[model samples]
Target: MKGITLLAVSVFSTAFLSFTPLNKKYIIIDAGHGGSDAGAVYGQFSEKDISLNIAKEIHKINKSQDKYEVILTRDADISSSLPDRTILINNLNPEMVISLHVNKSPEKETPKHGFEVFIQNSEGSKKLADKISKKFSAQTIVERNLHILRETKAPAVLVELGFINNTQDRNYMTSEKGQKEIAQKFVEIINEY
Candidate 1:
């Protein structure tokens, strides 16, 4: 939206987005922030690391299933410009685009915990976001626009997995079991479309 700023400047290109064979059903899992851009950080954990771990798990769970083929914006911890990410995602024309992220807020600024699913000003995206929110027991926000949501040809949503600053969110996201469960939930949501 108006006030929502993302890491849009890209020093990387389409090469940063790993591609696979063209499939009938496709999904693009964008692991937000990487390389020097650690995103939200708490202690030894970085938002980039958590996002990537969750994205990779989602890819692994769904890739071999033959329904929705998945591709990543960045395979590992590396920076890819926002334009490049959007360009690559739009080009794929995936069934949907889900950007993985972790939220952060100042401790004194009413620190937010739990999950949030963000959608652009579109009906389909909102529906999708809502479905995912229910799946995760998260809160859904309908907003003006995000680079990934506005630029992607497919339905898009940015999932704030949880707030790193929040103790419960931080623990759940960092745990192996929690990540797998989150990945499975996404697989179910993705296959429904």
Candidate 2:
């Protein structure tokens, strides 16, 4: 009877393992600009710093979850070329890619504000953009032939978080609370996928 019970337990364990789905959705979070490439700058704030902070936060929060696997192109202040980033992204073959950047208008105090989502000419990219844009106020989704968007193997979207030149945007992005809020929102959105 003991042997029969052991065999039954083994069979149950095999069946359970077969039915469990261990596949995690791989996602690439590319932080725009780094090192000398400060991207948009306003006063003491640099786009590179802001983007990396947010990207790291997202990665940190997502690491605790089992459904999604988050990867960042550059986790430090070092500069990484676009081609190199694209190659790594394609090699990983992630399910989705979101590039983070801060926008800057021609004028520092320009009235132009809010986020923008740029996507490639594919339905998958558009769908991803639509989902992301819906969460933010004053978001514009447009088609762009950017190298990252064009070369990536998965549905990709370049999100301009906000204008660095604008006072409201700058204040929000620079603050730690605001960064955490942005990261939390992104994590919530990612979990939906």
Candidate 3:
């Protein structure tokens, strides 16, 4: 009986450790737009504010796991140039980079209000993008010629959380509940990979 109990405990401990790998560390979270660059503004809500809030939430979640060394591109309300942002990401060389932003569209009726993930023009990137998009159907994931994607040395993705200009999107993105859901979903996708 004693031997059986010891074996059961060992098996459970090993299984738990396998699911949570120790090597997975260092994630870069880039909050798009800062300082003077307000990004897309809908009523009183600005894209920069939304992005920062979501990024911070993501950081908090990742920290709780104790598996990732999460770093933010910009911690305060300061403007960072495109080149500067890329440089910062490159310097960090994290295992994964996630750039967060809110979308905007001129056509009010264009029914495109969801999260989209953009990866570098590569096969591996596409695979990662597809996995994340499928998990979060709220946003469509597509590739774009983004500076951050091209400049980052690590496997990176840029996420447009939602369209600030869209009335429905704006309401959800600015709300605390909505932001928490988005952040939680994002972490799940990352963990899945």
Candidate 4:
């Protein structure tokens, strides 16, 4: 009886371990700009800093989902070349890639505020871009020809969260509440996919 009970326990434990959700689905989050490349700047805010903060927030949120494994192309304030970023993504072979950035519109005085998602010039990429754009329409504008999207081996998109030159955009992006909301919304989008 004792032997049979031990065997049953072992079998149950093995099954549980095997079936546990470990978030094996890989995702690469590229934080655009770093080091000398401050990207767009508005007032006291730098586009590179905004992008990294938002990417890190997304990473933190996704860590709890147990269904996604998030990787960042540039985690710190160090610079990474465009080719290197592409190579890293190719090596990881993630299910999806999201490159975060801030937009700049010098010609437009009024706030050009909206989220923009870019994909490769292909059917698959367009479909993904459309879905993401539609979902984030209230906060985003859809775009294409982004380098990260074009170079990544996996299905990828570049998200221009908002324009740094716009006063309202700058304020919202730099705020803690706005960053959290943006990160949460992105997590929702990934979860849906």
Candidate 5:
């Protein structure tokens, strides 16, 4: 009887260890465009590069935290199709997804600036966007039918960090300090989730 009980306990322990704990929340940080798809571009600044940097920064910061598991769609400069990204997101079934990007206005050096948070029609998506926008003191929270937002199974928000064409917006987004601050904001927000 003792031998049988010990064997059963060992099997249960092994099975529990093999599965992910329910207490930890999984979050996906999607770097918008990459490689051939350089999203919004202005001078030397590319949206793909900026978004990737921010995503990596967030992941790095989250590594120290025990309650959350942060994942990135692409860690390098490679183009990933919308469908592929969506599939990954759906498979992970994360608690939330944040897609990072830099925006560009049609006009040269356009004054349009500041961050914009785009969400899907779902209530959870809207709530997530509201939390992020409030953190940045952002005014624009638009409902968009973007591929990433529409296709992802989890609550997701697409954030346009800043306008690349605007001088102030461009400078802030490209600088290391700005990126760190942006990344820090996300870490803080994720803690709430």
Candidate 6:
């Protein structure tokens, strides 16, 4: 996590927005699971690592420009509980929360591999998910009561970036080209939102 810094450090208990003097438009990027919780794993790839890599790419891209003020829930490969993440995010009062994750299939023999975006019951959340999903040609805006989507107060999205169990998805998702492309799509989504 060297050279990685938070522009705005949030305080959790009181549940309020905090901003770096330089910027006011803020967003939180949550890199799914880390540490021992490998999320969806398949042979050479782990969802935690992949999510982090993509999140880092997003951070790097945002750092270079006077875009939105971005902050990641976990900057490194460290474990952070979903509840704690929810609490932190609720307190931050960001414009949105993008929780990066990888999708998996129960049966790898016939895998459904595609980018899927999940949204809570909120209309704004659904619209955001739809916009982003459409841009990536994703599966659809899935209305799911996922932990992050359900708990966070901000207009939140839980993006199943791609399926790790699928052959084609695995190759693209784990590659530098795919990660950067996806990261760029995220930036586009945020800016356009």
Which is the leading candidate under lDDT? 5
Error of 5 at 116 (Å): 0.5
Local accuracy by lDDT, each model? 0.83, 0.86, 0.78, 0.79, 0.88, 0.84
For model 1, the stretches where C-alpha displacement exceeds 4 angstroms are: 1-23, 108-110
lDDT of 2 at 73: 88
* Alpha-carbon TM-score of each model against the true structure: 0.85, 0.86, 0.81, 0.82, 0.88, 0.88
Clashes of 1: 1
Q: Count the backbone clashes (under 3 Å) in each candidate.
A: 1, 0, 1, 3, 0, 0
Q: How much is the lDDT of residue 18 in candidate 6?
A: 31
lDDT of 6 by residue, 6-84 (tens): 2222334243443245347778999999988999999979999999999999988888666687789988988777877
123-171, model 5: which lDDT tens digit per residue? Answer: 8898899889899987699998899999998999999999999999889
TM-score: model 2 vs. ground truth: 0.86
lDDT of 4 by residue, 45-130 (tens): 89999999999999999888966778888789987778667766775567788889899987665867777777676665666677
* TM-score (C-alpha, index-matched) for candidate 1: 0.85
Greater lDDT among 1 and 3 belongs to 1
Deviating ranges (above 4 Å) for candidate 6: 1-19
lDDT by residue (tens digit), candidate 1, 1-193? 3122222322232333345444466689999999999999999999999999999999999976877788888888887778778876776678789999999987745678888888888777888888898898896575757888888878899999999988888899999999999999999998886
Candidate 6 differs from the real structure by a C-alpha RMSD in angstroms, to one decimal, of 4.9
lDDT for each residue of candidate 2 in 1-193, tens digit (9 for 90 to 100): 6556445545654564467455645789999999899998888889999999999999999989888789898899997778778867775667899999999898644556888999999988988898888877536899999999999989999999999888898888889999999898888878886
Rank by TM-score, highest first.
Answer: 6, 5, 2, 1, 4, 3
Q: For model 3, what is the alpha-carbon lDDT of residue 99?
A: 87
Model 2: residue 193 alpha-carbon error in angstroms = 1.4
CA error at residue 119 for candidate 5, angstroms = 0.8
lDDT of 5: 0.88
Looking at model 6, report the run of 10 residues with the lowest lDDT sum.
Answer: 1-10
Badly placed stretches (over 4 Å) of model 4 are 1-23, 138-143
